[model samples]
Target: MTTSTPAPTEAGLDLVTRLNAYLEDVAATLGIRGESCSVDLTGPVAARMRLNWRLPGFPERDVDLMWHEEHGWSAAVATHSGDGHHVVVAYLGGRTVASQPRLVARFADSLRAGEHQDCWPGPPMLRTAGGPSALAKELAAWA
Candidate 1:
């Protein structure tokens, strides 16, 4: 049987919705112009059988996105189980420059605490959405 989450009534969402709302606040900054609270609604599942199916893959749960006007998608914090699977959140303009380690550090707890942060196209790849998924050398695996 499929896992059941609370269905949102015409008036409001279930617990997950409320939590995402809270996470969004912690992840985003004032300088950023956009604030989006979204979910990768696949499952509250698992992600590693080491490459096997038996290894319950991580579920696709809710992730918070906090965009900085000066930066891009600076943070992406999750509320439940499958939390730190993502690396970069949202990409900005068309020039991925100035994404400092300090900035990414600020977004840490917000974007899955204990996860590593890496910007796609850290230099010239700044302004594009999903600037590039090419893993960074220094990355400890995009948490």
Candidate 2:
């Protein structure tokens, strides 16, 4: 029997490129090095960014920001575990997909001050179920 692999969809590629650019914007807004930002285009499409400064109360732990297609943006502390797990501290709960870089920087600033009031206890509820292509369309207007 012969098997063939399917090519990556154009929408998926577009989403990846756009998401990478978004992460770069976020890093620039926060004054973080570009190398500290990364995006995972597989599955649900997610991005992770590491801040140079630590969280206010937890001086030893590093702060990280994450974004998911279904959950928007979140802040967490990178745990000591080498398995890449994090302790979620807050969720930036307005839009379920994307938030502007300035808004993200503002959120991070609030987190550093230990006075962030806009945090949601859990990840934001899903707003769209159309998956990658849908997310790409939504991110199209991101600037």
What are the RMSD figures for all models against the true structure? 17.1, 5.4
Cα error, candidate 2, residue 111 (Å): 0.2
Q: Which candidate should be chosen as best, given lDDT against the real structure?
A: 2
TM-score of each: 0.24, 0.87
TM-score winner among the candidates? Answer: 2
TM-score, prediction 1: 0.24
Error of 2 at 1 (Å): 39
Clashing pairs in 2: none
Candidate 2, run of 10 with poorest lDDT: 1-10
Candidates in order have lDDT scores of 0.31, 0.76
Candidate 1, residue 68: Cα displacement in angstroms equals: 21
Candidate 2, 1-143: lDDT as tens digits: 01121356887677665666777777889998878776665566677888888888789998889887788889999888867888989988885466888888898999999977878889887565476678777778552
lDDT, model 1, position 50: 12
| Model 1 spans with C-alpha error above 4 angstroms | 1-12, 30-37, 45-143
